[model samples]
Target: MSEKPVRLAVCVVTYQEPFAHSAVCKSLAGLPQELLAHLSVVSVCNAAHGTIADDPVIEEHQAGALSYREVLRSDNRGLAGGYNAGLQIALDEAPDAALFLNADGWVEAWYLTWLLDGLRRQPDREAFVPTLISGARCVSPFRKRGIALNFYIIGWLCLRDGPFLRQLRFPDEFWLDGIDYWLSVKMAEAGLRIERTERCIAHNLSVSDQFGTLPGWRYRNILVSERRFLRWQKRPFREILVVHVRALARCLRYRRFDLAQVVAKEFAVALHE
Candidate 1:
């Protein structure tokens, strides 16, 4: 007898934008039936601008084969809260693997299959981060020797098993800014495997390009997030200092003094923490 297929669940947290929401739905709709048969989708709608859960685009594309659930909220609960809402529903189904996908990002048709295949090939790995396709020239400046850092996994696609996530506790207080780092750090500390590969791929909606004009709250989030991340990760003082220095330089080069201030403030907080 053949073995049962692994169950996969995807949680997409969306706020305001309907077009982007539909885009993700359409992308998922195009997945092969073999995968879709065991796939469940949860769309958390935190529509501060307007309603998107009822948008015809999402309704039409999120039908057939795959199981779908919608959690609609009137206020924007931020990234972590929105994802936690959808995750709660997905976890109830107890999927073999669950992915936290951003509403503005979409993976290729074969992304899920490739990731599952890789995990199957290497069963030890608990978490997988897909390569990001974006318009930004330099997404992260924190390079080790020459290789660039992988800071893009936070919002793109954080795919992992249910059991592992439950152990670490999914998306906590640091969810707003350093969520990706937090999860990666915890997984490493727990001796769980995390691998980054090109086979599984996703595309960002060029949102990082607008980092210069982000709201003040986002900068504040970054400050708070880094302090928490530094404490939890137990990174050396020199490494953290160098990273913030580079960050300040980058912000100034981009004429975003506001962001530079955020970097400085985070460094100051880190000193006390």
Candidate 2:
């Protein structure tokens, strides 16, 4: 006559970082036994040309309290593909929620517990996310300045409810960039709520050093993704222009002339289309 606990699937998509994945598994394994009993760990290995097959820690922890599953792929399908592959398997189990965990990061056990409680408190919400930590920085760009949107999220512990999965899926065109932004927009368009937790926080390996040296291909992808997203949203040319103009100014301020030029060209294309 007791109420059943909600089932959760923690889907982690990893490429070649076995050590990071192991650390993540270790962190999950350390969760409270009662909490672990209601969750499953799904690790998607997206290694293209590596001999490594399985993660022992994930397998070993499977027997104890938490259930674990791994989806092995021989080709690199990028982030969306990898996550979708694992998501399909997780979806088959019909869990109450699925948390997309970054392989390069780990979450505090208490944070996840808090997130689950928040989800229960807000049943109307389609998704819940924990505040993120990387070194000394908080992932919320506007949090420190007291300006935060209701739907600002970045793929860490993105706990999507059953209704969310029934309505939306990750786009196929998305490879490595813009999927998260696209999803946030899609959810907002659908009038679905995505709440951010206050006490819960996930830690990620900081990549602040690479921001300044991002390659041209990445910039090009950003431009294309922004255009595609705006067009999909049916945004007006003037609105797109305002967005690009601000982006152009930011690029120029950062001395990224190459990206500034790309943004200018994209703005023209958006104007015409």
Candidate 3:
């Protein structure tokens, strides 16, 4: 009998950048047809303009490899709510695995292959992470000392094809990517094994980015999210400092004193809030 094509779902959460999201969907269409068969997309869009149907890449592919679906939202939950909406669709569809990708990331076939491999081998407990590359450096490829340091757009893989669970454990509250710090926690609760893959995916870290640019809305979101971030991801004072150390230095380098001010003021000793 012929091997069954993987029923994969790529769920993207995006805001105001249509082209960036298009690049992501393009990557999906660009995947070799061997892997693209039976793949579907769930675009949980937060902006009024990011209509997935109009993406040129999708037009070019004609949903060739990817069937598209959307969840248009106007909520402030940001990553949390967006992901919740996507996962809901995934749950209903009962796909083998769903990749929760950020809209701005550019993915490659090898990473998707890796995700499928894990899902095929152990769909119930397997959650794969692709090597995250930024500016030529491999960032957060593996679990560092038991904690993930800024997991890049390889993002979360929610599994359902296996025998363990029926649905994904969704994030409760996060603004933009304040959710990154909370992802592993939810995976742990869901009994998923976090696996690091050797394949690399380049994340521009430019579009739909917060920590890099901290645009007006993102900056304000940061201010709104700081207390909870400090509360939940509380670690040692030194570790917390180390996390923001680069952010602080960036403030001095690019003259982003505003972000620096927030970092210095908001990122103090971690305590129960």
Candidate 4:
């Protein structure tokens, strides 16, 4: 008898760009056929008032192998909402694990195997984040902290457990920013373990260039989310104050007065809430 291949769902959320859709689909095509056989991709395209033709790259990939679903949203629902929509689909489908990948990100052939292997080692773990490599540099991995927030610095290819992530919902109030941070923190608070994998997943996007001219409302949403997380974690008032002070300094340094004011207003709202 043959061993059953692990069932996996690859969730990719998209907005506006057809090229991103193509890139993601192409990357999936690069995976081995045997592994692809056990995978199902769920793509949520948040076009939100526009219609786009089926991505040719996706079509081409599907022709060769793998099963997928493309969800087209009539209106622009932000990242958290889009992801939540995908999560719901995954739950309905009932895969062994759901892998969330950005539409613009490309994965190596062994990406699923590597991530799944790590996940299998820790039966208690609910979520796993890959070692992110943007260009040539490795992004910072999650550090474990004691009551004093002690950080553990591990090897470049080390995997560490942090928090659990299951049936976790992103706060609807925030449109963007701080979603990832808040999710991680909340998972920790829920006592669910999150692990960082040893393999590096390449991210081609540039962080600085992406948020160049984001509007004030979006920044306000971020501040609101951060405050919500702080409250959820039951952080000390002194610690919260310190975090805000640092945030204010960064805002001033960047001359983001609009964001600064929005954050200030959000602080008042947070206090009352």
TM-score for all predictions? 0.73, 0.73, 0.73, 0.70
Candidate 2: worst-modelled 10 consecutive residues by lDDT: 141-150
Report the C-alpha lDDT of model 4 over 96-151, residue by residue, as the tens digit: 67776766666676767776666566666666666766667765444422233312
> What's the number of clashes in each of the models?
0, 0, 0, 7
Deviation in angstroms for 41 in model 4? 0.7
Error of 4 at 82 (Å): 2.1
lDDT of 3 by residue, 38-96 (tens): 57777776654544543222221254555577665544346777777666676677677
Deviation of model 4 at 28, angstroms: 2.0
How accurate locally, in lDDT, is each candidate? Answer: 0.64, 0.65, 0.59, 0.59
- By TM-score, is 2 or 4 better? 2
Pick by lDDT: 2 or 3, better one: 2
lDDT assessment of candidate 4: 0.59
Relative to the unseen true structure, what is the C-alpha lDDT of residue 219 in candidate 3, on a scale of 0 to 100? Answer: 55
Runs with alpha carbons beyond 4 Å of true place in candidate 1: 17-22, 47-67, 119-122, 133-152, 155-162, 200-208, 234-244, 258-273
lDDT by residue for model 1 (72-137), tens: 676666677777777777787877777777666666766677666755676676776666655544
lDDT of 2 by residue, 1-273 (tens): 966677887788777654234666777777788788777677877773354644322232363455677766666677787777777777788888888776656667776776677666667777777666566666642221121234344556455556667555677666666676666666666776667667536454222435467676776676677667666766656656666787788677778898788787777777677
